[model samples]
Target: MSHQRYEADLRRLFAGFPTGVSVVTAQAPDGTPWGMTCTSLCSVALDPPTLLVCLRAGSPTLGAVLDSGSLSVNLLHQHARSAAELFGSGAADRFDRVPWVPARHGGPHLVEAAHTIADCTVTTEQAVGDHTVVMARATQVTSLRRPIPLLYGMRRYGSWAEDMENGFLSYDFIS
Candidate 1:
């Protein structure tokens, strides 16, 4: 397929795949907080607790995260869409609108996020066409909220709602 066709098809294909939302955060040398909401976070290993995140090329936070040698992955809950938008935006003072605290390892952690995974360093970075994939070693993990995760799919956000039992065998059995 042509490059344009491939791009369009990829977008359509990805839209069908539901992904959990997260915000990757770090602080610059001048104590300025930086972050970006991403669905590109993936687990790379279990024994070593490693993960990967893809950041767009030329993002200010990307270079700062590389320089800081660490980052915190803040998992957004189903109710944190506003926080997600704030971090995803290109506007300054994104942190001003969100409640957060510094991670034990020194990166910014969203105080109300579902959870946080603190990575110590970028073990490797591969430059893709328009983004760079960063592999990091997780040093810590913390849960700030319940396990209800925020999901993105088909260009929308949705949550799993439990149906009450209506004398149905399947519902009663599960309940």
Candidate 2:
């Protein structure tokens, strides 16, 4: 297969995997807030409460996080596509159009996000190509909204609804 064909195939393969969308935020020096839309966040452990987030090496938030020594992961709801787009944009004043409050960990937390996990100090950073995997210890967590989580599938945002089972298989099945 040719290089172009390989690239297309890789893209198609990745398109099938769904992921939860989140906005990772931190405050830059001079009190400027910065954030980026990311889907590369994952829970690494529960014993000590750890998580990992991947960011591009050249992202503004990356530098801010490193400088400030902390960051916040805001899990967006299915209705927050606009907020995601705003943070993903290249605009300088990204926070000017969004509502947020400072977390107890000193990171900015999206006021309306479904949930937030604020980390204090990065425990480890591993370089991978043009991106870096930042592993941090969760220092603070909060739930700001009650709703279905935002999902990314086929490159779009979707919601999940609970399916209730009608009266059917029950009590007598074990007999």
Candidate 3:
């Protein structure tokens, strides 16, 4: 099989898996706010509280984090579907539509839309094909412990309806 075929298969397989939605936010050196909805965030360690976010190559938010040297991974709640949609678009000013406050770590935090957030400083980064895996040491991590988190599956935004007897429960896997 071709390498491209393997990549396509991997994408399809991952897309079929349900995942939490998050908005990775940061500010440029010029104080411009930048954000993008991401589903590729993961916790890397616990002793030092490290996390990593996989962002598309050449994304402005990636550059912002690299410049600012910090980021906030805002985990969006179920009600933030619209916000997720907006930030994930090609709009010139994504932050204009959302209510946010400047994060202590030089980023924007959508307090109302997020269930929680993790502020971190960039420790390392690596290019992974079309994406960059950014490893950061969390400076502060906050969680509301909300019951429901925004979900993405099969390339669509959705919510955690409930645990049904019909095998329609939420997938317990996070990648």
Candidate 4:
């Protein structure tokens, strides 16, 4: 297969797997808030509360995180689809239009877009291919009770639902 076709196929395969959406935010030295929408976030540890966030190697957010040594991964709720689209664009003043409050650490904590705000300090970072995977230790966390989390799948934003149709629970039972 051609390289372009292979890349396209891989992206299609990836979109089939549902993932939650998040926005990673950090601060520059001049107290400017930098953020980017991403789905490449996951918990790596439980004992110390470690999270891994992957960002494009050339992203300005990555640079700010490196410079400030801190970040906040904001887990978006289903209502924040518009906020996601705003952050995903190349707008230089993305934060100017969004509602956010300053985090004690550095970055701005998005008020309504997120259900959980994890303020972390970077412990390590490695360049892998075209992205930089950052491993950070959560220094503080703010979580809110929410009904459903925002989801990304098939190149769209939505939420997860239980399948309750078609005569469910039809597996043969021995009990």
Put down candidate 4 lDDT per residue, 136-167, tens digits, no spaces: 99999898657367888777777755457854
Cα lDDT tens digits, model 1, 85-166, are: 7777787888877778876563688887645446457788889999999888888888776766776777776554455565
Which candidate wins on TM-score? 4
The lDDT for every candidate, in the order shown, is 0.77, 0.77, 0.86, 0.87
> What is the C-alpha RMSD, rounded to one decimal, of candidate 1?
4.8
Runs in model 2 deviating more than 4 A are 165-175
How are the candidates ranked when ordered by lDDT, highest leading?
4, 3, 1, 2
Per-residue CA lDDT of candidate 3, range 34-134, in tens?
88889998888998899989988898999999999999999998888888888889588778778898987847988878999888999999999999999
Prediction-by-prediction clash tally: 0, 0, 0, 0
Residue pairs in steric clash, candidate 2?
none
Candidate 4 residue pairs that clash: none
Residue 100 displacement (Å), model 1? 0.8
